[model samples]
Target: MTLVGRTAAIGTLDEVLAECFAGVSRTVLIEGPAGCGKSVLVDTVVERAAAAGATVLCAVASPAEQDVPLGVIRQLVHGDPSLALPEDALAAPGVPSRVQDTQSFCAALREAGRAAPVVLCVDDVRFADDASLA
Candidate 1:
């Protein structure tokens, strides 16, 4: 779908994407009432980033997944190619609440960032699992 009157928002996101590609850290939060096109805006930016060779990780959360541990993270990892995360990383359905597990996930993200610019997009984030949020 073509977005209307989002030139400024897209420009801002493009700048952030460039900064991230150049090894700088940036974050932007997009919020609005339901059906306001926040997700479409994000999807546009991330699709552009992916086309430019950035690693784009996205997850659209739902209330049904709120109780699942690391549900968002799991979705992100599973969507990545094999090399994005370690072969054994987050492979289990029921992830244990261990420090090592959390550390491993972090390590994997850091590793992926080192490989390429990483863009993480979480839509409907209010429904994201508490563990994933933490």
Candidate 2:
């Protein structure tokens, strides 16, 4: 693997991102320590996905505000105002507590993926809320 900077393993990430875009799994999770280049890998994957005509959604877990509900999902839908939530899904009982407002955003993501594969990157998992992690 070629190191892009002092930390990022660019070459390895590039290969993985390529496979991700090729519809290998549709979901790619890159986990590592704070300074271990996970964000760098996500960035590389986003770039490659864009180049391949895929939509990219990204969310970062913040250490200072890990309790925020649907923080990651909010970030993913912020720019795409047209995205809609599923009707009444949020009001359903026994729905996973961790995934709030799930109907709309989840449906929006599924719709986006139908048009073209979407690369959703969730970084800083260690700082993510336990509910969100579930």
Candidate 3:
């Protein structure tokens, strides 16, 4: 479907995309109430990034898994089983914790970015686990 009434969002995302392509670090957080086309808007951006030859990694948070630490990160990392985590990467504790896992995820993301322009997209972040979101 054609994206309608999202010229501003699209323009903003285009700027971020341009920065990413230019080897500049950037982050864009899109938030809105449910059924307000947030997902659609982000999906459009993802498509644009891919079409521009960037490697796009995406994770969609699930309400049922919100209590699972690193659940969202795990989804992104494991989206392609070939993506390897470092041997020194710390595992998530039995209890939900943020720092170690997020650090590992970020490191892995940095490594992936070395191969190509990496666009990390997290959808439904409002439903992401506290540790992951924090």
Candidate 4:
């Protein structure tokens, strides 16, 4: 479906993608009130990135999952098996281990970008699990 009234947002995303392709890493946050098409906009951007041969990783936050530690992180890593944490770092079924710490998460994110320009699209940040957001 065609997305209406988001030409400027798409244009900016195009610029950001270009910069990332050029080895200049950056992050873009798309924020808006609930039911304002934020997810649709993000999906459009992800589509563009995919068409351009970018590695796209996505995670969506849900109210039900908000209390689950590292819930968002788990979702993000689930799409890419190479992102699996070492057994030593893996927490019990639903818990986030101390070894799966912020430092390690950031390190992994950087590593993914280095391997291939990655477009990490996270939606519904307000509902993201608090621990994961940290």
Candidate 5:
């Protein structure tokens, strides 16, 4: 559905985007039941990020059984090939593999943001595995 004329949440998102551009890490966790416009909020953030010259990476989880691990990372890496994986982090035994991957991906995204901001969007986080949540 189109989000035209949706001001209240979009205005708040604009404020959040301003903060992100001002060097604050934007980590907004939108929570509500279905049809509450959570995805719309995220889409607005992404649009703002893009307008501000920020790289955007987005992933959505499916309820189907064939989903893969680090699907978000795959999307981010696909969007920007310069995003690198840290070798040292992957070698650590204690780290959950996906966590290491995600962390390294985030680090790369943050570093890239130094040149131009980056926005990493992960949808259906409620379906993410506990290990991924850690």
Candidate 6:
């Protein structure tokens, strides 16, 4: 897919995907105004990653779910039996144990990564649940 004005951004993400496939862990955050195509950019990458046989986990956050603890994390792995991960019980927001919750989430993703190259894409992240953001 050739995006009109996103060649550079797409190239960067493709390089990230390449690195990911090469066994390098990567984190990408795409932030912009409501109509700036952040989702489009990420969706494009997700498609590419999936096409390349990479494991693609995605979540789109919204205000309605912002108060749901670990909501975004749930979106990533919920109902995805391929991950074969046990459900996590994240402590509620403002709990000091959130640090550990983050590690737990990472552990789950790390387990999945062991199976294949993992590409996690979260969009509209401004409204992600607090604990999920940890």
Ranking by TM-score: 1, 4, 6, 3, 5, 2
| Model 6, C-alpha of 52: deviation from truth (Å) | 1.1
Selected candidate, larger lDDT, 4 vs 6? 4
**Which segments of candidate 1 are over 4 A away from where they belong?**
79-96
TM-score of each: 0.86, 0.68, 0.81, 0.86, 0.73, 0.83
Q: Give the per-residue lDDT digits (tens) of candidate 4, residues 1-134.
A: 58789889888999999899889988899988879998999999889888888888789989998888777778888857666655444465466557446677778778877856888788887899777787
Task: Estimate every model's Cα lDDT from 0 to 1.
Answer: 0.79, 0.63, 0.77, 0.80, 0.66, 0.78
Off by over 4 Å in 2: 1-24, 84-100
Q: TM-score for candidate 4, please give it.
A: 0.86
Predict model 6's lDDT versus the native: 0.78
lDDT of 6 by residue, 1-134 (tens): 66799988888988988898889988888888779878788889889999988988889999998888777887887677654323345334333335665676687778888878988888888998887787
Cα RMSD of all models vs. native, in order, equals: 2.5, 4.7, 2.8, 2.0, 4.2, 2.9
For model 6, where is the 10-residue window of minimal lDDT?
A: 88-97
Please report how far candidate 5 places residue 106 from its true position, in Å.
3.1
Question: Regarding lDDT, does 3 or 4 come out ahead?
Answer: 4
Q: What is the lDDT of residue 97 in candidate 5?
A: 52
Writing each residue's lDDT as its tens digit, candidate 1 over 1-134 gives 57899989888888988898899988889999988999899889888999989988889898988877777877877755542334444565465445565677777778888978878899999999776786
In order, how many clashes per candidate?
A: 0, 3, 0, 0, 0, 0
- What's the true lDDT of residue 4 in model 1? 94
Give the candidate number with the greatest lDDT. Answer: 4
Q: Which ten residues in a row have the lowest lDDT in candidate 3?
A: 84-93
Q: Candidate 3, residues 20-53: lDDT per residue as tens digits?
A: 8888999788887779999999899889999998
